[model samples]
Target: MEAYVVATACTKFEKKPNQTFKGLTEEVYLDLLREAELENGDLIGQAWFGNCGMGTFGQRNIRGQVCFTPLVNKKLFPERVGIINVEGGCATGSMAFHGAWKDVVSGIEDVSLAIGVEKIFQPDRPDMIQEIYDGGIDQFDKDEWIKFYKDVGDQLGKPFNPEEKKGTIFMNTYGLQALWHMKKFGTTQKQIALAASKNHFHGSLNEKAQYQFKVSVEDVLNDREISYPLTRSMCAPIGDGAAAALICSKKGLKLFTKEVQDRAIKIKSSVLTGGKYRTLDEPGLSRIAAQKAFKQADIIQKDIDILEIHDATSFCEIYQLEMLGFCDDGKGGQFVEEGKTSLDGELPVNLSGGLVSKGHPVGATGLSMVHELSVQLKGEGAKRQSKRHKYALAENGGGVIGFEEAACSVIILQSPF
Candidate 1:
């Protein structure tokens, strides 16, 4: 059986101080059903719910049930739908999406739903934000990472300074990697700023984006420094949001209207790879995932018409451009600097502003990527839609193990048009 995305929806990626997790989930859920022209959730055979911080808020166990059971009791969701909770750090949404795709393709479920919701912003309790990100690293291996950063700093002639660190330690990690790339490939800070500026412009066109204003390259260079070479504008902001995708098999597609089926995108390939502890010379996990995904899809990197990557920082976009083989290693900086990934460039990337400006709600981010690509493929991206819309790719990474992401998922979708 082949799986297709018949419907998708996303809430604005912003901090909703008064919103609860249930509220976010409900918003996207109803919106998705409406998009699919389904009056109720009876057609959903299974569901995968992705979340990260509810555990910190004391909803540690049975998170999916806790959030969905209310709807079931209120007669919104079907009572018998099998709900599974998922977490993979920031890649939680991708993981959930992968699970639903598997359910349909494996002939286990004809229709499956994937939803990711998160509420990480706490205005009165700012420390809670730090606590959420801290969970991305190994808890027992703290000293090991500490020494690893110190060793890398010493090798680069920029000794580690805890006091100089800003945002999460992850920022420090990205800063160190950016610095190393600069030394090795002559990647300039200006190039990184250029990528940030481009995404900001793209964000300005996305009403659903958290930062919906264009930022100049010079402004990005002058923003508040988080870690050396990384400014606030270049980093993904902390926020809360929810997103959902409804996956249906060929047999299940008949349940929806022609309008929904016509716009449905085919899931050509989906690949997830685990992270490993390796040296800087080794390829990142996304590289490995992308290779497998392309091979599975029977398409090369050039076949991708649009892309959404895990751009947690501007440097991440540059690094991912290389890792995904869009450009050769050490040339990602030049690729963006030359406007190859701009909205009107060769390969439009992060037209939804990506994690940097789209707001990294962690759990919802990957599905948010799916939502944007689906919209573009359907020609529904009013302002930011690109001319090319045949194949769309999304690469989402989760956690940080060693010097790279602990888990990464790469998905390729083909346009129904």
Candidate 2:
């Protein structure tokens, strides 16, 4: 059985200081059900809840049950619907989609629901952001990361200020890797800023984006520096949000309306893999996963009309361009600088404004990326819709283990006829 995504929805991502996880859940669930045109909740055979805010939310165990109890009525569900919890740093949402996709294709169920929800906004706590991100890395290596941050200034031949850490410790890792790219391929800060400015422009077109305002490359350069060569505008903002997707088997498509069936997106390729311990010269999970996805789908980089990459930082967009085979190894920065990834470019990326403007609620990010792709394929992207719309790709990376992401998932989606 082949799986298809008939419906997708996401809450408007923003810094909701007073919003609870339950509120986000209720909003996405109702919107998703309506979009799928399902009057009966019994159509959902199982659910996968992806989250990473248990430490801050104080519901570590039974997280899926806690959030669903108030929303999903047991009597209305399919017989003994299985509920699974998934957590993979920022890629938690994509992980949930992978689980649901497997269920639909393996004949385990005709239909399944995937939801990624997170609440990182705690106005009373100043350290909530730091504490939440630290969950993705090995807690035992806390001292090691601290020392690395303190010593990075000396290595870069500049004085390091602690306040420059405007976001999570992950920013420091991105900074160091980016600085190395600059030292090797001569990647300029302006190139990174250009990527940020483009995403900001995309955000301005998306009403649901967190930072929905046009930012020029010059504005990004003049913004507060987070880490060396990285400004505050170049980083994803902290916020809370939820996104959900309804996946169905080929046979299950008969149960939906004509409009729903016509708008469904086909899952062409789905690959998930782990990161290996690598030195400075080794490849990362993004490259490995992208290669597998393209081969599995029998598609090339240019075949993808629209794409969304996990841009935790602006420099990440440049690095991912090369890893995803959109350009040569040393030409990733130039790929963006030359407008190759803009809205009207050969390949438009992060047209939903990406994690930088879309807001990374950790768990909800993958689903948000998927949601944007689905909308664009259906010609609902409004101002950001692409002229070329045959295939879409989403690359979501999770956690920070060693030199790269601990896990990564790449999904290839085809527009439904």
Candidate 3:
């Protein structure tokens, strides 16, 4: 059983919620459906929606249905459209896609829509920051959490000790993992800066990227430090955006055009796994998910043509590259320095600027990755197209409370021969 993406659309991240969830989603669906030449009435099947900032947007459950049903005359067949809400910190979008793909593959639905949208910009920056933190903040002893964050920060050399703040756990668990990698592999801050620089350079060429300016490694290194060895440039900016993709089975593909029919990109593998809650060790879910995807796709790591990783920070990208078997452990930094992940390198990665430069709208980030890969496969990636893309991989991780992710999804896509 195979599923293919027949249409896709995404909105640019804006500081203000100029477009409400309903407006943004309707626009994306209209555009994508138009491109696929599918009428609104054709989309009567189930849908998997991913969104962060629901509370921020003042929306209730099944946000996608509520936002899109009106556009299609409120005739959405309730029996046909089973809505599922997914929350995976920054990987919400990718998680939604995984859910939709599962439904189609399992014969639960012949066609399903996977959409990710987020609106974080509120009236106050502090309020928005609080909202973002609230998504990951554990409901344990608030003071203890704050103290733990402060200790983590102090150990990482961060200036602000969050432990002093009430109910604030500023621990970016990944920071500790990153520091470990640096200590063991001799990975330098300069190498991480280089990765950020590359992302910005690639992002500058993308019209949809929020930040279009090219940055230097020095700029990334010298920028204000959020965490030890992580500067502002190394972090992903929160913004507002939406991305949508229509997934359908082989039977449903007959409704599309011959061009789309002939150029379908099959879903070779889609794997979602949760973390093992183990700190200071390799993420079991990431490893297991990668293995499952590889086996399902019938391709090894060496055969992957391009990859879009959940690089919330430069180190995250490096770690995932190593963990996914793209390179040996402790050698990811050297791999980046060698230009192995560059556009012209042996394995191009994050060709669409990634979350670093692309603006991670949490829920929309995963779908954005899928959209970029699909565009690249179709030779429609305008400016960020890779040299060769026979197969593409996307890995999205979210909700970092401790050492492991709360949710993670890995998808393998291949251009049909």
lDDT of each: 0.92, 0.87, 0.78
> Per-residue lDDT tens digits of candidate 3, residues 230-266?
7789878767888988888999888788977877778
Write the number of the candidate with greater TM-score, choosing between 2 and 3: 2
TM-score of model number 3: 0.92
In candidate 1, position 244 carries an lDDT of: 97
- Give the candidate number with the greatest TM-score: 1
> Across residues 1-417, which tens digit of lDDT does each residue of candidate 2 receive?
578998999999998988888788888988998899876567888899999986576788878777787665644334466789999999899999999999999998888999999998777886876788878887886666555545654666655453555667777778777887888798999999999999999999998999889999999999998877889999998898999999999998888999899999999888898975566547788898999999988999879999999999989899988888888887889999999889999999999999999899999999999999999998899999998888999999988765688899999999984
* RMSD of candidate 2 to true structure, Å: 2.0
* Per-residue lDDT value at 285 in model 3: 62
Please state the error at residue 175 of candidate 1 in Å: 0.5
Query: Rank order by lDDT, top first?
Result: 1, 2, 3
- Which candidate gets the maximum lDDT versus the true structure? 1
Q: Per-residue error at 217 for model 1, in Å? A: 0.5
Candidate 1 stretches with Cα past 4 Å from truth are: 162-165
Clashes of 1: 0
Q: Of 1 and 2, which scores higher on TM-score?
A: 1
Give the clashing pairs for model 2: none
The TM-scores, one per candidate, come to 0.98, 0.95, 0.92
**Of 2 and 3, the candidate ranking higher by lDDT:** 2
lDDT of 1: 0.92
